[model samples]
Target: MDSSEYILNAHNKEEFPPAHTAEHLLNQLMFRMFGAERSRNAHIERKKSKMTFTLDHKPDRKEEKAIETEMNRLIEEDLPVTSEMVDRDHIPDGVSLEKLPEGASEMIQLVRIGDYDVCPCIGRHVRSTAQIGRFELLGTNWDEHAKSFRVRFKVIP
Candidate 1:
């Protein structure tokens, strides 16, 4: 697991899949909105019922607003979220496949949001964007060194 902390979602399968998928979308959105990337040690604590990520930059209110808009749009659009089997060798050049937590098998499953979001993922998510329901930007803040920004938010189904 490369030593990064791992945790379980507070909710069971049904609740966790959508919430966790939203978190992954948030992770991708932040990257697109800004050049910053998410931390490899990222996790969504379903039990804690909170979603957070470590980022290289903190978005000001304006940026957060834009992100909130983009994210919610993604959920509302409910783009078809699909996955399939792919050979480990077929993984795209820039994507990282180093940490396939617990149940993720060597065959590898990848999730795609519409045509826009595509990455290697083991977590469950809505089959399409429509199932994502509505999303709101709860809040965000810069952590200790400004080297990381933590975002907390949720999706309303």
Candidate 2:
């Protein structure tokens, strides 16, 4: 048996949608800018929430700021978000997969932004990116050797 369980306590559905979705944008920017990959993600369910994740590598201050800026711009653009099913044998032209997740069935769910990020995901997202209403990633610190980072932030009201 597993020694521990990762549990998320969402008081209400209202607390999670936007913040979790924003993580996707941050994930893409980190990969594109710093060649970092998300190592793990744990989204907590509670009021005054916090979600933490790690990266393959640490990002510098400049890159981190750029990530914050670009993400906000995208959210401001209010990019339309949508998803569809694609055959596993058929990878859509031009679309990219960050990492091949195992145990995926024959068909994959594709979550997309008009001219932004596109990858297979099975998570909840806002109707439009803009709904995220500003991005804030708290306590930007990471250990290169450990390959770990802790980010605790919530959406702006």
Candidate 3:
């Protein structure tokens, strides 16, 4: 479809593209490793970001380190990041509409990171994975009762 045919949601925040892109990778990684859904809450910024996921059990230290390692590996792969405008009625398999805003348009913009991840998004992102600096997991907190795992992280150039 032509550019005019695409409808992007109104993004209120000017996010750091690298960090924003990393959030996508992290979300995909979390889903793959834990059978968890993508993070429903995220705070992406230039210096740091945080994402919270609901899981059946908290990931231990070894698993957390593996997350960092895997994220960096993906970034080093220099995967291409691209976006496509798809009709809302024909959303691709495995692409979830759960995160779409209530008033999202009929034409949705889907961001894909190589073959690793794809989701409906309107935020800015780097054109390639290598453009995202090193992925670092700074800390994590688990609320057992709530089954929530929150991770704080940042990227280094």
Candidate 4:
């Protein structure tokens, strides 16, 4: 079955399977690089996606490039994109529940990218990392008042 089937909702909105999955991978990468929180806000779409992270300072060009490079490297690794439903009590440590919406079910769906990342997600994803192709960093923005760093990106075939 196509991976796209996992992400589409009743609204019939177009959700790129690769992009949605890549967003999850990128969030883990950002956490490793900056020790900051995972995306607090994200706009996941077919054309492009944006995620916001709260950070003390903005990332420089070199860091931004590194983010893109690492994501691509992981994508090229061909890691399996797998998911399973687990009781909330079994949710592992270090997997944040912040992204989950209010009144989320006790049975959570966990998505894992090889040995790299694991998070509770209900979105659709490709069967493997290779399907993600390449990752591109379009631009970034920092909100001083909110102390939030926003990154815009896209996945290329």
Q: Which candidate is the best by lDDT?
A: 3
Question: Would you give me the overall lDDT of model 1?
Answer: 0.65
* lDDT agreement with native, every candidate: 0.65, 0.64, 0.91, 0.83
lDDT of 1 at 39: 47
Give the alpha carbon lDDT tens digit for every residue of 15-113 in model 4: 688998898888899889998777878898777899999888888899989998999999999999898776768988988777677777767778898
Global Cα lDDT for candidate 2: 0.64
- Residue-by-residue lDDT tens digits, candidate 2, 1-157: 1111322122233436687677677667666765656535556332333434456666678766777788788889988878777665677775565454554455667777766777776667787888878777665656677667665555673
In model 1, the number of clashes is 7
Q: Which 10-residue window of candidate 3 scores lowest in summed lDDT?
A: 1-10
lDDT comparison, 1 vs 3, better candidate: 3
lDDT tens digits, residue span 4-75, model 3: 566567779998999999999999999999998999889988887999999999899999999999999999
As for lDDT, the candidate ahead, 3 or 4, is 3
Q: How do all the candidates rank in terms of lDDT, highest first?
A: 3, 4, 1, 2
Q: Specify the poorest-scoring 10-residue window by lDDT in model 1.
A: 2-11
Q: Could you say which candidate leads in TM-score? A: 3
Query: If both were scored by lDDT, which would come out higher, candidate 2 or candidate 3?
Result: 3
